[model samples]
Target: MDVRFRYSDHLVGLIEDAAVAATRIATAPVSSLAAEALRAKRDAGRLSARLDASPLDDATADAVDAGSWARPAEERWLDEAAGEGWLGEPAGRRLDEALGGRVTGEPAGDAAAAQPADGWATALKLDGMPTQQVAAVEYANLLACYDAESELTDQLFEAPMTVLTTLHGLICRGLVAAEILGRPRRTIQAVHDGAQGRVIFNTPDPRVVPRLLDGLVDWLGATGPAGSAGLPTLVVAGVVHERLLEWQPFEAGNGRLARAAARLVLRARGLDPAAVAVPERTLAADPGGYHNEVAATVHRRGDLGPWLEW
Candidate 1:
């Protein structure tokens, strides 16, 4: 159940170019104020694309659109985080902020009177807003906070699972049943292409899920910046994305979590620490290509050059 992949010289060269671009995107001579604003826009675009990638009914999409009124609150939250120097703090403190309801949103209709103390309980004050809207808004906030964490540390590599579960927990807060929240799947899992109406692949046995994840984290730490021989950040990001998608650890939100984690890798590995990169938008733009690449990797048993190249 160890992590595995193969790539060519062409892939290596392409990833090298990507690594340079990623590094420059964050390090270029942009003012901090402008960078923060640009990051906010990037987050919104990425979050919107991610939601669009999921299978949503028209009603849900419309509801989520109505919920977009919370954008002001989201901006305010990001502003506060940036101003308060919350970016490089430990991931646990960020998780605490999420668990404390600070990252949740109130109903858009009630936004004008929103108080700092309202927190998640105000989500119950959604009035007529669909709960789905709350989920979407919460996701937007959680992802922004996650991406804003720019500091890389050895702790992250040593216990990558902590970050993954924390993210899964944030994502599934109200979307999934409580018992399964943040927990690895205990039963068999299969990935189905609802758009194409076919099974893409079956996951490893649940018993192996934990071991496979351990292998992934170990590989990540070994080949990532924490290790002596680090691969290109973009290459590591691609492997993180595909492997997490292949594992199917959580019953829900696996795709979202994988993308978020991949972006984290980009940030942690010095490619896009500012996290303005919207790679998910590229994947979301062509869902068919993304799925096909993943399916091909699954069938080929960790042959990831095609996915990486794509």
Candidate 2:
């Protein structure tokens, strides 16, 4: 039976904090601090922070970080996606049209219509899903991330700005791939067992994704947002992002899917959908760290904590 009715309203404030934190960190300049020092400084922990003993405080650090996070280090791909602003227009208009339609399950009102009309629109849909259907060991995988958050907001908390609903209800648009839209990858499996998998870098097999996500959904459904032992929203989002990438559910577009989910969680939790502070920017900048941490989750410890910290 479904056990998603037990969620809490506390996630709202937690998510808001995370969204703000992600946005601020994403926009910051490359810190001159040593790598470890940088990590220590950015983490929200106070005791851990005292170890660094830097004069930097949260607000000042944010200003300093955002002020120069991109001025140094890899300056090349910083605005890469910014150029692709291609999706901006299409996503906005779709938000408007869908809202205008006011479909019960879709976004509505002036906010949807307010999205900027000037954007280089691009078609966002899935065409040829593999002709051979990958039979579901189970189909609950379809709702994967969305279902998790949707239940949190709708079943447990207020119905507004949920996983399925968001700024302008824009989430109504093509938030994910077409064929596999919101499901977990039944075909994706871990490349190896936790033991050997750690020694080598085999991309996780997609086969087990469905089972893993199903278990995850069940856990979230049963216990609710308070279930993760009171993990911060951003940490939770980070775990979701890292695990999804490792799962690589879709035959294609896994990265986009993962980042989309991350962005949504941030927005759903109150990151100001209009804000450009996406964690993807941070990961994109630190690919090495991203890869290593993600690897550690499945490989080294099979624990998501490391990835969340990353």
Candidate 3:
């Protein structure tokens, strides 16, 4: 990826509010949407490269051009690519072995024994990594991640709570850890307190997650009508994003869930309804900036200005 501006650069120096920026983007000329499709393909390629997966091919790009996203053929190609991305070649091999030495038809939680490492390089190529299996549920999860994008366009416009439920539900749909699937810890829990514990960078306490989430969602118009904030959809998406990250409602898939949730806000508001912005690639392209800004924003007061600027 080319060098891009940091979160603080404010390189565009747009003085408009997030709302205006969103409108400007949403109303972009139809001619430009073709270009947008191209960029989306480019982004998918970057994301695949970052994840040590194969780049999406020209036909996949043509799929986007033909509006085949979330379609069966598109899903088969893209979802499998995403599955490959989530589990690089090595982890895929480990998972392949654990799936009774194949990639398909494994039982759920079969790879429950595999403990993904802590932090960003969780399952990329490394020597003698412990997690060496793919559970049936994890395979379900891979398929679900691709399938959910199709659902987002319709659901993102529903009630905020509905949207919230959808986000968690999607993340939980094919969870490898059957234990934590669709359930938030009722008792107190900490990311750093378990055998899987590692510095999560930052996450609110389990006790406070509900409270903070309640407050944030209400402000976000989740329980009420959305777009009440009057902010640009982009800004709203950013806020939804940061709040989801800070709250960390789920034991796993929080980052993936948050990214999808943010995209939901955009899709609901017609900012990126085609699901082509590929913000995940943006973050993947600059993991350092993402980590730094996520820490900086949450550590201080709930100021979203810096992240929005980025």
**Pick by lDDT: which candidate is best?**
1
Error of 3 at 4 (Å): 25
Clashes of each: 0, 23, 3
TM-score-superior candidate, 1 or 3: 1
Q: Give per-model TM-scores.
A: 0.69, 0.41, 0.55
Clashing pairs in 3: 18-232, 19-232, 95-134
Tens digits of per-residue lDDT for model 3 on 145-251? Answer: 54455554554444454445444543444332333433343333233312244553556545455555455545755433443355556666777777666566655
Return the candidate ranking by lDDT, descending: 1, 3, 2
Worst 10 residues of 2 by lDDT: 131-140
Clashing pairs in 1: none
Error of 3 at 33 (Å): 6.3
- Weakest ten-residue segment in model 3 by summed lDDT: 129-138
Candidate 1 regions with alpha-carbon error over 4 angstroms: 1-7, 32-135, 141-148, 151-154, 223-229
- Over 186-228, each residue of candidate 1 has an lDDT whose tens digit, in order, gives 5555676766767777776665666677667667567545542
For model 2, the stretches where C-alpha displacement exceeds 4 angstroms are: 1-183, 186-200, 203-205, 222-226, 271-274
lDDT of the candidates, in the order given: 0.58, 0.37, 0.48
Report the alpha-carbon TM-score of model 1 versus the true structure.
0.69
Task: Using TM-score as the measure, name the better of candidate 2 and candidate 3.
Answer: 3
- Candidate 1: lDDT of 120? 21
